[model samples]
Target chain A: MRDAFHEDLDKISDSLVEMTRLVGSAMSRATTALLDSDLGLAEGVIENDVQIDAIRDDIDEMAVQLIAQQQPVATDLRIVVTALHMASSLERMGDLAEHVAKVARLRYPHKAVPPQANATIVEMAQIAERLVAQAGSIIAAKDVDGAEALHADDDEMDRLHRDMFVLLVDEGWEGGTESAIDVTLLARYFERFADHAVSVARQVAYLVTGEWEHKRRVGAPA
Target chain B: MRDAFHEDLDKISDSLVEMTRLVGSAMSRATTALLDSDLGLAEGVIENDVQIDAIRDDIDEMAVQLIAQQQPVATDLRIVVTALHMASSLERMGDLAEHVAKVARLRYPHKAVPPQANATIVEMAQIAERLVAQAGSIIAAKDVDGAEALHADDDEMDRLHRDMFVLLVDEGWEGGTESAIDVTLLARYFERFADHAVSVARQVAYLVTGEWEHKRRVGAPA
Candidate 1:
């Protein structure tokens, strides 16, 4: 029933949904790798990121082809354009996961996150995994309400990000500078992962609702 | 002399060049604020980022409008899409600079970079500034060679990043945990800034040469 142009768009959308799965899987396994110091799992996350990047390239190519052939104006054009931006955000999310896995890999034979920060790191990873999964749902259904709901989880992620610093700066902390550096970068990777997810959700909302919220929400860069 | 489509694209290109200036200035000032502990200078960089972000939004709008109106295909379409991506990278470079400023602000009345790491941070900032300035020139001229030259600076940035980590973990280091956290984050903000500059340069090369490099070169997250 779908025309060629719509069919191409559909394929692009499906590929995007697949990206969410790959990125989500990468982050979940990367987190486990971080917590357990699983070198194999960490290596897997880093190695598989090329797949995510490849999908992004394919989506960009498809979107450009659609634009050139169909010349769809107004809403159709906006969707394609917004999809390009979304693909970049998702690719960056994969990179963040790869970054987390690198930390795990770099610390092989030792836990990247110290015991004091263990519970917080676990919670951060859980929220990150959920956010990306929701991002996938938001894209599949084009659900603006679902996109808006991502805000609460992102807020929770930010809270955890701040709480992480509190633990790092606590006087009783004894993780040493190396573990502290690891935790600082690790927390940022998780926090940035959530930020990118929220960014993807916002782009979805923009297209679905046709309103661009240009408000900047980046509290602090890692 | 130029048709309306090329004229519109010329405007977008001009805006992109302007972005490089604003972003480069922000990073330069942010580094100063970080090293000198100048709260006022840091605040200025933080406030001026909105200007950088605004230009990116304007460029995106212009690019989208150009695509819709002109219906460009092939090389033309690719160029417009690449501009959109370059805009995002430049905007992120601004945010990274702002992140550096926030680190300085957070450590007000106390220095953010300990003396041991100060020289490397300064060198990193200098390279970040040069890369963005060159990014601007590359955009203005579409100089593929200039874009290619950015790799050397980025390689140096990476080497400094690795060097910073070595300093953090050294047994003789005495910057304390808080200072280490500050330096860790500050070092990462600088490193990511250069990465984005490299990313922007790569986009220019992609459009000019009609060749996209599928290589993955992210050394680490932080």
Candidate 2:
């Protein structure tokens, strides 16, 4: 049987996992919105970000309340503090998704991503979804191995980012400066989304293994 | 007389101010490097980021240790919790400055800011410096007014960011796709740096007034 403090911690953890799910869905839809230029779907992702922020607020309040009431020490305290950080990362992921959706909206009926970079954007979107999904599993199960595997997914995202850059600078590239700007920003959003997912996974791994380096500040350092 | 916990909190607060200083200097130097294409200065900013990371690690350890040893509750606990979030924002500001510096290095021997957009970049960098400097003052003084004033500075940042976009997409833009890409990312880095500064200020202000909204999750939400 769990104590009240542990119960609160579990709820916070559960909320975090729920956050991962919502953020995952957010990015998944935002990716579709970007590629398909679906205005309504883009609007939905932008509007729903508030829900993610609300969950973060709840987690923040819960963690602070837990600390004041339980006065947990040592590892328990670390868990609470780290939960705040993870909540933060999750919230930022939601914002990044919103940014993607807004980009789609800005372009309207025209697709934000051009043809040369479509495949890479699609793959990045897929990996972003997988990363956050795996981040959910990692948090729920505290699976360190799952955390270790997330780095590879992030690596692929980085490679796709580089490929996009190459296309942007290519001599034969048909996309004009305006398209290039949109693509560059879009690519960065996906890369950062994947990064935050990996950060969440790494934090979970560290909390489980008691081996956080504290150096993973900016979501895997690109 | 201040108790041991307050003393520790003071030290943590001091470190946050120090972080603002480091991050401020970093942005100042990064701007110079970007404009002048100074390889050595850019390299210095990139290398010195580790020190910023180290301070954050120190702040993290100090905060968690305080929580373990002090068991602070009520407003005191909120102050400590808010400190951790402030440290995070400052650290991210450091990363953004480093990113700006890296862009400088990437375009070494060639200026990152083109002639058309030079003035805006300079103005953006100046505001970034002021924002961090004021963030330091706000943290040290715990001034609510200082915190409130930060919003205006951030609004200026947003304005500058918009001006940058106008310059980029203008028909008269001569920098081509690559420069547009670089300018877009650099502009974002400065804008985010300012946002984080405002976030730190708001956290300090809230800790002082005991009115933290918890909705300022992603640093004032744009």
Candidate 3:
């Protein structure tokens, strides 16, 4: 029975890793589509979201079953429960990507704001992707150190978000109301995406260390 | 030993409910401060965050201890784990309220925008508070029905958010950049707050029902 339970838990973990990969890919593609104005890629993200949602449901079902049958205890219980939380965050990450794709489709063929603003957003997306990827790695390997590092990555995303706001305000001041509004909303979505990823990382940290470490690691030494 | 374990579990639940009450109050106070431009209230929220943070730490510690000692099974395990997720959401909710308070301080003495925009935002805050309060009740009573009702409440917040956007964009076109930018960011924060509350409601539903209910409740009479 213990062997069978362990096998089931392993299967759930694998599904979680797969879900993370798909959600991360969707986010990356969505952001790239926004930057390059690639409606085709954006459409692809929207379409692929169904698969992410399906997987999220599968994971949740599996978690419920594990609890009902296996009656998981100790670390086993934590793993199952944390998987459930991670699944929810992964699903939201997908939804945020879908939102980005919608924006991309809406603004297709029109450049978004100034080059600098677009470039900053792209950088922000990159950070978000890295954080999500690291979260996946921490979950798979239960790497506490990697999980700790994610806090700094999240802080950088926050700084970029603040910068994005400054750019949006400056652009609005310079008479680009329409484009500025688009950029501002887009930036807000990406910042929120990053925030969710940070949330996933924190969950990973809890799963690995068996503790919730709230103090964010300030940025790496200069 | 079983009786002792049950007692410990009760303590954990009590701590969770206490934290919930503190966070809910913080949100209410923060929104009131925003509406009234009360810097003292805003400062109180900023100062009170440390207490929230401390509560979070205590909950985390309790959860770890409960799992380590009792090795809870099934519903017991789910309750403890759900408490962890709820704590994280509540912490973020408090942070969002703090963000609003910060905005209030930034725009102090002078209103950020017209009374029309401010009134809509106040409405949004009221809706968010309702959802947050409902979430607390759902957890305390394990009321799946109440949790389901929050989904509709969330939709109302979404509609109000759309109205705010329309108003902001109209202001952008008519009232120029300054007014539009301020209202846009303010509206975005309130919308995000509602999103977090919806997330809390979803978690409550999952805890009670063992299913991943969509954040949007279906089949309710429009």
Candidate 4:
């Protein structure tokens, strides 16, 4: 019976890793599609997001069932509950990638991102993909160090987001309001994608340390 | 023992309702702050979001404890798990409200939504507040009809969002790129607020009917 419960817990972890992998791939492909104006890849990323959603549902259902059946307490319970949060953040990440893909599709035959903004956007996408990959490793091993590093990775994404915003609103920006909107929204999607990854990493850190330290960083009023 | 379990379940439901109420108030106040450029109200809303976060933590802890201690099965398990999802959505709604307040605070002494877009933003705020209030009632009563009606309310928000976008991109839009970003983001905050309310409502509907819906409506791949 003990072995069975541990197996269930392992399966939950496996599902989370699977979700991270799927979402990471989606972000990478979506970014490429966005950069290259590749409609097929963009459509593929959009199509694959459903799988990410389904996996998230499965992870959630499994976590709930594990708690209900095993009656896990303390650390074990925290791990299961944290899995739920991680799955949610991962699923949202996938949706952000889909948003990017949709934008790619929306502006097909014409790149939504102008040349001036492309480098920062590309770098942001690379950082986002790297963070998710790191997130998967963090989840699989409960690596607190890896989880902590995601914060810096997310900082890079934030800097890029700020840069894109500056470019969009700069006095000399020749990109019209439509392109401005496109890049603005695109930068946000990439930035939010990294934010979700950081969130998932924090969840893992919480699970490992049993201390919810990030709460204060969020600026929640005392 | 059974009665105690049911009582604990009731408490969980109460926390969810309370969370919805806090989020609703925050959105209403945030909107007013945005329109009036009231720094104090915006600060107040930002400060209050911490309480919503605390309540969410309380809900999650309670739900985890209930499952671990009672080992609830079937419908009882579903109720506990759904409450977890509801708490999460409500917490996110609060954060969205806080985002609006932050924007309001950021543009202090200067209006975020220019005169041309003010009416639509105000209407969106009212609708957001109304939906959350209805969401609170729906959670308390588990009213399926009320939950279903939130979809229509959210559709109204979507219409407003589209209108705001069109206005932003219109040839005559004199709001400039900065103001355009402000309104565009503001529109998203309200729309996402409604979307989160709809998500909670759908959770309630799923609880009552045991049929999973709204996943497709989110535009996730099939």
Top TM-score hit: 2
Model 4 lDDT, full chain set: 0.81
What is candidate 4's CAPRI-style docking category based on DockQ? acceptable
**Whole-model lDDT per candidate:** 0.84, 0.86, 0.69, 0.81
Which residue pairs collide, candidate 1? Answer: none
Tens-place lDDT digits, model 2, residues B46-69: 999989988987887898899889
Off by over 4 Å in 3: A1-13, A54-88, A108-116, A138-142, A147-156, A171-175, A195-206, A211-222, B1-20, B53-84, B147-152, B171-179, B198-206, B209-222
List residue ranges in candidate 1 displaced over 4 A.
A1-7, A213-222, B212-222
Give the runs in model 2 whose Cα sits over 4 Å from its true position.
A212-222, B214-219
Rank the models by TM-score, top first. Answer: 2, 1, 4, 3
Scored against the true structure, residue B32 in model 4 reaches a CA lDDT of 92
Ranking by DockQ: 2, 1, 4, 3
Residue-by-residue lDDT tens digits, candidate 4, B11-34: 898888889889999999999999
- Please give the distance, in angstroms, between residue A216's alpha carbon in candidate 1 and its true position after superposition: 7.8
lDDT of 1 by residue, B41-133 (tens): 999999998888888877767877898898886777877878888888888899999999999999897888889988999999999999989
For every candidate in turn, the CA RMSD to the true structure comes to 2.5, 2.0, 5.1, 2.8
What is candidate 1's lDDT per residue for A1-222, written digit by digit as tens?
977777778788888889988999999999999899999999999889888988988887898889888887766777787788788888888999999999999989989788999999999999999998998898889887676788788899999999999999898777888999999999999999888887777676665654544324422122
How do the residues A151-208 of candidate 3 rate in per-residue lDDT, one tens digit apiece?
Answer: 7777888898888777766634452676667777777777777777766666665555
* lDDT, candidate 2, A1-222, per-residue tens: 988878888899899999999999999999999989999999999999999988987887888899989988777777787888899889899999999999999999998788988998899999999999999999999786677777788889999999999999898888788889999999999998988899888888656544546435434332
RMSD, candidate 1, Å: 2.5
Model 3 agreement with the true structure over B1-222: per-residue lDDT tens digits: 447556776676566567667777877887777778788998998788778767766776677567667655655655565667667666666776777777677777755656767678778878877777777676677666675577677888889878876776663445456556666766766676667666665666655554434423321110
Residue-level error in angstroms, candidate 3, position A178:
3.8
